[model samples]
Target: MPHDEAQARDTYACRLARSLHNQVSTLLGNRLAHLPGRTTPPKSVHTTQLKMALAETVFRKVYKLGLVPKIIAKLPVLSLMLAVISVCWLLILPMDGQFRHTYISENALMPGQVNLYFRETEWNHVRGFRDEAAKWDFESASRSNPQLEGWLSDFGLKVSHHHDPQTNLSTMYALMHAPRGDNTEAMVLVAPYFTSDGQKNVGAMALAPALARYFARMSIWSKNIIVVFPQNGHTALRRWVDAYHTTLDVTAGSLEAAIVMEYPSEIDNFSFMEIVYEGLNGQLPNLDLLNVATTIARHENMQVSVQGTAPQNLHKNDYWTRLEVLARGILKLAVTGVNGKLHGCEAFSGWQIQALTIKAVGTGGPDITQFGRIVDSSFRSVNNLLEKFHQSFFFYLLLSPTHFVSIGTYLPSAAVIALLFVVSSIYAIARGVSAADFVASIGSVLALFFGIEAICLVGAISLQHIAISGTESSGAFYVITAALMLFTVLSSVGIFAVKAPRFSRPTSFLLLAFALYFIAMLIVTLLIVHFALAFCIGISAFPLTLVQDLITKTHGNTLVSMKARVKVVLCLIASSPVTMIVLLGYILDGGKTEGVLGLVQGLLSSWHEMQSWTWFVVALGWLPAWISVVVVCAFGDFTSLEKEKTE
Candidate 1:
């Protein structure tokens, strides 16, 4: 038992260890293979080996998480937190005087620095135009337009008429070329002759032509001044602007800025002036333009209002009153779905020209002379600009005429709302769903999405056509029909939810969520591009994304319980596009000083034009999201369905 025997024993022990290690390795590998999503182990494996293999397999499976799902699971709360913070940011926009007071950003726009020279001569001309124009209403406006055109031509300026055959309306304008510059850039002064109510902006129309004549005499001008006497409302201005840019054979050059004057009364005195900057579909003028207008108004000792309400005083009670005024301004910009003539300034914004409306509001003794001086001074500031109004903020929310919130301060709310959908869609995708399944599910839903879009488009077209072709009496019925159709289309998603199989339901939910997320992204992109359109769409549609993931955690259950179903139903109802329309209609209508029926009539008018993106965004963007939520809620309980199928 000496050295030779010891060597033999050591060698035998080494060999035994090697053999055991190989056998254990093989068993573990075979067990792992037999686990779910792996190849099955051979039948020849013994119980001891199988047990060892099973233990190793369990260990591996427990720790082998896919990177995406693991990351998503860790970050589910982020979206919620962002959403909460975003909503809170909105509240903070007004709390404790958080909004910053506005000042001019462009050095060239030296607001309120110029002394206004519009005086008795201008007033006399305005009076003459007002008195001469007092006989004209909407019906007679077209007939009298030639006379106005001739009068504008008498100022030795180039005059033109823009007529839209569809509405049988005419817009008359006169251009006075700049004596100093090449006339490559121009500024427009729009004076709507008729109000949306078919009355005349008597004072403004008179004032613009007089200003044009006065401006034509000034040899110091560096940009052409175009005086627009709009025959209709925003519609005619849109037409004229379109003609100047694309349709008409005229060289009006790039529009630098615009001023819209609406003085509907013959009193020649207004207590306050409302600065209407919110444009068509939420377009806004440059902050510089607003600042210029406000500065001039203030200099003239004129009380200024943003969206038509001026805080009477800064007293403690009036602080909340100011807040209400601010909220109204924000909401008006947020809900720019309607077409009113006073918003002609908004149409100019779409063409990249900064514009705003100076409407003389309230009755008696602010003096049209003061209003004219405000316009004169504001125009002088724009005339000083060497380039476009790009130096100042193109996106802002006016709290008062003097206070505002820029994009950086107020954008987080919309961004957070859009981002929630983004995070949720990513979370859904990360939930172990196969890429092919995701792709196939998305493809299926795309078909459904486009089909739904087609149906909606046809319905919209039919309603629009019916409204146009029918008499005034039938307009209400057609509008009601359109509203009902929209509701039905949105609510119909519940039908598919109740019918979709449990197996594919989660994937379907993911697809729909992704579609919704994409829509949100589009809205965000649009917000970046055009804040008003995007903001309105985002706010209206954002609530639909707030619903709990209806199909997400229902792994064992296919159908939700009756209680859960009720909650889902209620949520769907609350966030439905139809409901949003009604709520928005109420809010807008309330602001209109019109009752509920008035809102209905406005909605009908909006629907009839089919030009307003307000209804379409609701029907298309918000409707699909609503439908997706309903479908997810209606999904059968996959766990129970699978069990039933297997049985």
Candidate 2:
């Protein structure tokens, strides 16, 4: 109705009001500013200010990686990540690898040389020594072998001797200290016995004197040699070695290889001798160096046996041969158990010591001095080492005389089980999970751990008492039983009492671990004689979560608290994947191991002789797929739900 100017002014005012409304809405959530409907663009910063701000922002984010709530608090992504990690074991890997690694770099080897006539010629010296040793009437060598040290001292060795007659049941020890003021990088142990009257003794005590005489007279070795005359096997030998190690300046590297001669009647060092590399698990020595020695031995016409490869398989690289070795080596030797001293002490050399024994049972080969030179040469070869095999694989299994599968190739064995950890954690954080459910779930995990312990102990006992009675039959059984019972009782009581007192906590844990071992022994003992394997199976099946949770939670950590929840989810999901396999195992009723053990078995079955590349494929391929299933199933919609809640 007004003039045209009035109409224009009115329209302009309306626009101004709307602008003010937007500004207010943005500035004060739509209540304070007049420009409520407006969205103001941010003011530009100067170049200097912008750069400074960006740098500061980056620093802040990085600094908070360990401290911020979001790092551990980001549940959805973490849950998904964990889930994928748990299920990857279902994938398959190539089981057949060309027995040996063709990829091992060979530039550093001194591979082909033979002919140690010096060793073969030592037979005459050995015979005179053995016959004299047989004539002496023997007592516990521990009580009477001091003169042997004087004889060794004359041969240019610093002899430090020990005799623990009462404690060791008369076993003697003569430690030949590595000679100083020389490049003493090797040692040879002569196990010939002392001559005595038609001696009646336990495990042949007089044999040591003969060994002393045989080695002291040998002149074929260029390396420093320890011509030892121990009272008996392992016990006396370990003590002598221990004493020698202590007296010598251990900070300096000395003493290269050790050779123990067990043959009593042999008068000669024959052609090349057979090499026995004993034990499978942690006790096994480095193989590259070993292979090199074997090559040399064969070149010298000496045979190599893993352990008395009876009626020997000359073509040892066959699949079954390799599989049996890998399976038993990984599962049996890797397991923690009481062991014989020879294999046990061999572990000290970081898996490098080899034992060469020449027996008179149809095998005509290398004798004492021939064996000595080989020991000397082998050590000299090892001394040539510039490093501790850091670049090569640390864990591996030999499938054949020439074949090997590395730890990288075998990781699925562990990864499959490790995934279960993540699965269990995811389950704990699932929407409906509560403390009660957590405990119940955790209990099952505990049950599995206990069950596995029970099984392993029982299996070991059965293997001892039933399958094959080992060297120390009665003592091993009794020791094992006592150990299990003690371990269990301590673990239960200690773990349950996490809050007894600050100082007492560690005490409790120690007591508990011991108790767990004892409890294991008792359960194994009470188990029906025939059900030993079941006991072993049950113990292996048990989850480590109970112990993990106890330790992790007792420490009281935000990171661990979150991880605890994650462990629950993983344990839960582990059930589904584990279910079918368990049902199948029960149905089959044979060699039924569970949890980490099943995955271990699965991996062994699939990749007994897998190559390096095959291992890589299995780890990546299997780990991701299984982990993916865990993510989708357990972590479903968590991110979206969070975003919706935030919105």
Candidate 3:
């Protein structure tokens, strides 16, 4: 009986299997069947369909295994790893095989190829002029200097003067026509009456005329030479440059390059030549021009320093030293770009002029003769250029006077940092869109962000007008008061909005996402014109990204944990632009109150005089982003108030 039952079951199973297989075969045949007179499907089509089926099965299996979701979950970690890798890549650039050895890209710049004639004879003239300049009453000197004008006139050059009504300062410039060539291109020799430190620049004053006299005699020149003695400070230089471009009494050919000589000490000796090449708005002279100057200085047996790094340390190429130099270069570049402080060379920016400052550093290493030789050779190299500075890089970071990293290599550093912001923004946006109240959240976020940004924009415009219209003291006072008022108002609004009963998680996430997106865009925009500034701001503000996760975890909590509170404090401090500025001022000036005040004043002055965007960026871009983060993290997520109200 058992054997009969098993046989019956087996027969039934076989029959069922056969029935299913026949049905599947019939379905396939019907699906593949074409209309009357249609051609049969190709074997390749069947093969392709089979492959697609296999791929779909595999994909289903993978998806079921949750690999894709896992990867998506790990995206932030992956992004962090990439950001770290990018930073490591940037840090390693000072190592050998990382940065390129700087070369003269412009073949016309045959630096140090010509024999230098600036010797003891010129040194004697320099000393004599130094004594004569030292005797002048520089305190009352303005609008004109008969001694300087007479000296230039004696050199058989066209002398002219420009007075700026705003600063009540004067600029005296003399043009020396190239004896052999048409007055189509000119080089400048700037010897500001005062050094960057506000001391009497007797040595530069002396050197300018000596070089002018020496250049006057040389018939091998092609471009005309202009010796400028800009009085007051960098503002004076800017006035002169502006007038030279627009409304000068005497004009030469288009200006091509300028060399600012800064030898404040009456003594003729110096340890090294510190090259100041960073310009206004992060502008840089052509790389070839810097290369030419450094090469000539080195050839003349004069040590060369850049961005205040010691010349001796540069030769060692010690990893720490290189790193320090790299860091300093970036910091200085950022400061210069943001502040537009007059470093002599910065005055020549925005006019297609390649300019650098050669300041005599230390004392008793090389005499004035060697310095003069460097200047002379540099001018000769510039004189050889047939056109404007176009061959070499306009953007580069000097690891040392000899080595540098070009824009192509270093730009990725800032780009990667900016990418970090983008990733954070995308993550925030993804989470924001998934919230239950997405549409309402987006509307609120847009209104909140735009409203705050509009206020900031108005405030920035007002500060700019104040900076431009008011006197320095009154302008600074009003700016400070207005800034404080704006800060108070914005902080109150952010705090009040975030603490409101209707504020929700979606609103917080959307706000953060919007702020991050704004920052990312700002950094990317700045990267093109001011790489160091962009990188600095990017890294400094990266802590804001952490606030998003913190807010997510802490939102609606009755009591925030100590760890979360500490994190909130840290984020606030780290991402605060005001804190960064104050810290920078402290680092730069030893925590002096005056230093911070002076920095603020300098920003105002830069904006008023040169139309620099530093203040605008700080007021509109950075401060707004920071405030948004602060609002979301510090006040947006604590739902205890809502709980209390419900009770």
Cα TM-score of candidate 2: 0.49
Candidate 1 whole-model C-alpha lDDT, 0 to 1? 0.65
**lDDT of each residue in 61-95, candidate 3, tens digit only:** 55445443344445577567757876797788988
Candidate models: Cα lDDT each: 0.65, 0.38, 0.75
Can you rank all candidates by lDDT, best first? 3, 1, 2
Better of 1 and 2 by lDDT: 1
Error of 1 at 528 (Å): 1.2
Number of clashing pairs per prediction, in order: 6, 113, 0
TM-score of each prediction: 0.78, 0.49, 0.86
lDDT of 2 by residue, 346-386 (tens): 32232244433332222355545544444445544544454
Q: How many backbone clashes can be found in candidate 2?
A: 113
Q: Which residue pairs clash in candidate 3?
A: none
Instruction: Give the least accurate 10-residue stretch of model 3, judged by summed lDDT.
Output: 638-647
Which candidate gets the maximum lDDT versus the true structure?
Answer: 3
Error of 3 at 639 (Å): 7.4
Error of 3 at 593 (Å): 2.5
lDDT, candidate 3, equals 0.75
Candidate 1 positional error at 223, Å: 1.6
Instruction: Give per-residue CA lDDT, model 1, range 1-647, as digits (tens).
Output: 12442333234334434455567688667665666763554465456566776765654443343232345544457776766786577667766567888898889878777656788767888788778877666456753577678787888889877777876777777888888879798888888766555567788877777787778777778888888877655566776787788877655678988888888888878878877777655667888888888888777777777655543552233456556765676666655535232456756645788887777877865788788888777777888888887877877777667777888887767777777778777655544244566766766666766766677677666655554555356456546646664665556435434554653754555655665676677668766555655655555555455444443333333355444444545556666655655566557655442333344444445544424566566556666666655554555322221211110
